[model samples]
Target chain A: DAGITQSPRYKITETGRQVTLMCHQTWSHSYMFWYRQDLGHGLRLIYYSAAADITDKGEVPDGYVVSRSKTENFPLTLESATRSQTSVYFCARRTDYGYTFGSGTRLTVV
Target chain B: GIQVEQSPPDLILQEGANSTLRCNFSDSVNNLQWFHQNPWGQLINLFYIPSGTKQNGRLSATTVATERYSLLYISSSQTTDSGVYFCAAQTGANNLFFGTGTRLTVIP
Candidate 1:
């Protein structure tokens, strides 16, 4: 489709294991963002990329790594998953008007 | 960094009822947007109102940038309207910040 999509909508991983969530947007938006949503705390930005190869950390970036090798794709990786990292991860793209968010990936680490 | 606060952290309404959600920001903003996260966890864009007011069907939103706040009104609510409504703002620095959101549950 021509919209944003996230893979592995639901995932379960053991603590200390490596995991990656995929995001793809056909709109070719210049700005891509990754956010994690948990109870009590709202959505916190983990990382954002202005364009391919240009990335910056947001409010919460620790324990998360993001790369945008292509304008259409931005993936977030967890080097060593932890129970605290278990949450619903969302991918979004910023346009002139506002943002378009993916369906989200629910990650559970035990 | 700007701070965004949303009022009525949780709300319950009967179908066909009307409700209003409010969002307050700590600083001036250049972009203001309202989003509806459906029950399925899909974030859908509702309105991009930086200033003034706009109405779309049974939903309407108003942003008073100078006053540093905004309001979202939903009339004749439907069961499908149950979800979290988030209000986000882009400050002069060009970074977007979202509020905790208002969780609305509509009962039929």
Candidate 2:
């Protein structure tokens, strides 16, 4: 796809293990975001990067880490995955107007 | 942080029916966007209406920034439209505050 993509559309990992969700965009957008979708809370921001090497925390940033080494790649990593961290994760690129979202990655920690 | 609230948390309708979804924010926003998440969990951007109104195909959206609210209208609903509709508001910051979402089910 030419827009945005997330790797490992579905993932299952053991608790206390580390998992990294990969996100890549072809547009070279200045901003990229990581979000988790839950039952009642809708989508909550996990982290966002304004540009390469410029990142910031979102509403729910605990237990998660994000790094943007390149403008096209923003990967979210869970240092120690927990059952509580099991949720669908989405990556988005902010366009001039709105955002271009990628297909979500469903993560399950057992 | 902005508090985004969506109305009619759930809605059910028959094919060819019309529907309206509303989103209200607590503070000023840099942008207001409406998205449709299909059964398979793909977030498709429907509208990016920060103010005034915009229409595309069978859908239309209006955002009154002064009023701090936005409305989404879906006309002639179809079974394919059975999905969750979400309204997200973003301030100048990078993060976007999303509403609880409105679950819509269109029956054939």
Candidate 3:
């Protein structure tokens, strides 16, 4: 309850459908990030928010969108989910020392 | 963009053995971090070494910022330690570039 948390620990969606993954951090960190981990690729950042209403694209932001309406929330949305988007997604908050990641969301686009 | 490379893509060791994982970055970084991704897919921060050494329990890390490299040491490895170890370098812009990771397997 005191750390970052991602909703829908597991999700399955059909290709071309819209899906949204939610991330909430209780600490209200100024920086929040979304990263997708794939085999052989480690973790690739998809989007990041520096503060409320300020977001930027990361290494792999092609089909994803992000919004930070509040310091405690950063949600990632797949406007049109594709099979290639199937991967384990992690939400993290930049801490004083380093970044703290959530449990991860396993998403499968069929 | 920064490039992060990790050595020993795969490793197998017996329990109680000691191991070291290496990470190299292409450019200068403001800080370096080590994380352990457990089999359950949880990324736990191990160290936040910028240019010094720090230890926690059986794990220790050292980052030579001037050299653009970092090392993570795990002593007396256990089954629980069998996971993917990743090193991430943070730039001045606060973007973290992660290494491909070193997967370790420990057998009893």
Candidate 4:
């Protein structure tokens, strides 16, 4: 209840469908990030929000979208899911100590 | 962009054994941290050592900023320690670059 959390621990979607992954933190951290983990790629940032209404792209942000209307929530959306987008997604919040990550969401596209 | 590489892609250790994991960065790092991805896919932050050394229980980490490398030491390994260890680096940016990770298996 005190840390960040992700919704839909596992998901199966059809190609070309739209899907949204929700991330929420209780700390209201100023920075929140979205990353995807693929084999051999480790974890690459997709998008990040410095604060409410300020979102920026990271290394790989194509085909995905993010919004942070409030400090506690940063949701990532895949407009057209593809097989290549199938990977574990993670959400993180920047803390004074370090970045705090949420329980990842394992997504599959068929 | 900074590249973070980890050594010993995979490792297997007996319970009560010890192992060391290494992380190398391509550029000077402003921040360095280590994390453990558990079997349930939770990323648990273990250390945030940009320089010097820090210890917590059986886990300890040392970062030599001058060398651009860091090492994680785990003594008396346990079954619960079986997971993937990842080191991430930041080069004066808000984005953190992660290594491929070292998968460790501690068999009982």
Candidate 5:
């Protein structure tokens, strides 16, 4: 129960509704990242936080919002969900050696 | 930003066969990692070989940073090894850039 975990593993929302995916890691890793995996595009980074209150945009940050108020939590929110945002979202925490990813959240926008 | 490319985009192997997956990067990298995403969509860390070689069970990986490439070998593959393998790199950045990945299907 001490590893990274993502809530709402499976979600379905309307196109214009607001949705948020929660990611929590107990390791207290300094780096937390959010990535969206889409067909043919691989895993594209949406945002990353170096430390508490320090966040940066990644390759594909548009249509997505992220915040890191606590070192152990990095949540990604979609202000207005779209059909294109329907994909498996993954949250990862980076230690000195490597990264550990969550089981992933499968979000479907109708 | 560094570009990471993985070879043998798709592969099929028998349970007792051996296979190798390659990853090439466009620039020098300070960190390199190989991950196995199982059928259940869990990304498990296989190896964090920035340079040199390391092995675990039937899996092994080598990262030749000087050449900007890495190779992952799986021997006596099992049906459980059927999934996508991803190679990610960090070029002095805090975040890792992942490749398209190599999908390996092991038939028993």
Candidate 6:
């Protein structure tokens, strides 16, 4: 319960709606990441933040937006949800020991 | 960008058996991690062996940076170990590039 957590464990939304998935960590890690997992593909990074206000794109960042206003929080937003974006999204934070990952959020677009 | 490849895409073992999973990367990396994704979609970090060897309970990992590969050994496999195992690597402080993964099934 003290590690990383993702909100809205499962969500269903329309293709044109904007949906935001939340990620929170208690370790105050310097690096946080958002990744989406799809069939036949490994976890692909959508965005990552080094610290508050410092964010950058990853391998796949077309319709996703991420902001880290606080070291303990990194929220990912799907500007306009697409059926193609339906997958299990995971949030992870890097620490001295290793990476702590959230349980993941399953998002389905109609 | 570095490419991560995992061998034995799928593995099946009997309970109490032992297995080894391998991961090969295309370039050098600063961070290497192993994760187990359960049926519930939780990615549990198993090890952070960028180099050298480390062991925890029945699980152990070795990362040979010079060889650009890593190996994970699971001793006395259990039914609870059935799931997908992934290996990820990153150069510098960049985000990790995960391998396609190895799906493991442990039968009773």
Specify the highest-lDDT model's number. 4
Tens-place lDDT per residue, model 1, A11-104, is: 9999999999999998688999998988888888899999999999999999999998999999999999999999999998988778878999
Query: What DockQ do the predictions score, one after another?
Result: 0.74, 0.89, 0.80, 0.91, 0.83, 0.86
- Candidate 3: pairs in clash: none
What are the runs in model 1 whose C-alpha is more than 4 Å off? none
Residue A84 lDDT in model 1?
A: 97
Q: Give per-model TM-scores.
A: 0.96, 0.97, 0.97, 0.97, 0.97, 0.97
* TM-score head-to-head 2 vs 6, winner: 2
Stretches of candidate 2 exceeding 4 Å from the true structure: none
Clashing pairs in model 2, backbone N/Cα/C closer than 3 A: none
On the 0 to 100 scale, the lDDT of residue B39 in model 3 is 90
lDDT for position A103 in model 3: 90
CA lDDT scores, all candidates in order: 0.92, 0.94, 0.92, 0.95, 0.93, 0.92
iRMS, model 6 (angstroms): 1.0
What's the candidate order when arranged by decreasing DockQ?
4, 2, 6, 5, 3, 1
Q: Please state the CAPRI-style docking class of candidate 4.
A: high
C-alpha lDDT (0 to 100) for residue B57 of candidate 4: 100
TM for candidate 6 is 0.97
Once model 2 is optimally superposed onto the true structure by TM-score, how far is the C-alpha of residue A86 displaced, in angstroms?
0.4
Clash count, one per candidate? 0, 0, 0, 0, 0, 0
Candidate 4 DockQ, CA atoms: 0.91
**Candidate 2 chain B: worst 10 consecutive residues by lDDT?**
B90-99
Report the C-alpha lDDT of model 4 over A1-110, residue by residue, as the tens digit. Answer: 32999998999999999999999999678999999999878899999999999999999999999998999999999999999999999999988888889998999999
Q: Model 4, which residues run further than 4 Å from truth?
A: none
Compared with the true structure, model 5 gives a TM-score of 0.97
Candidate 2 lDDT over B4-99, as tens digits, reads 999989999999999999999999998999999999999999998899999999999999999999999999999999999999998877788899
Clashing pairs in 6: none
Score residue A51 of candidate 4 by CA lDDT: 98
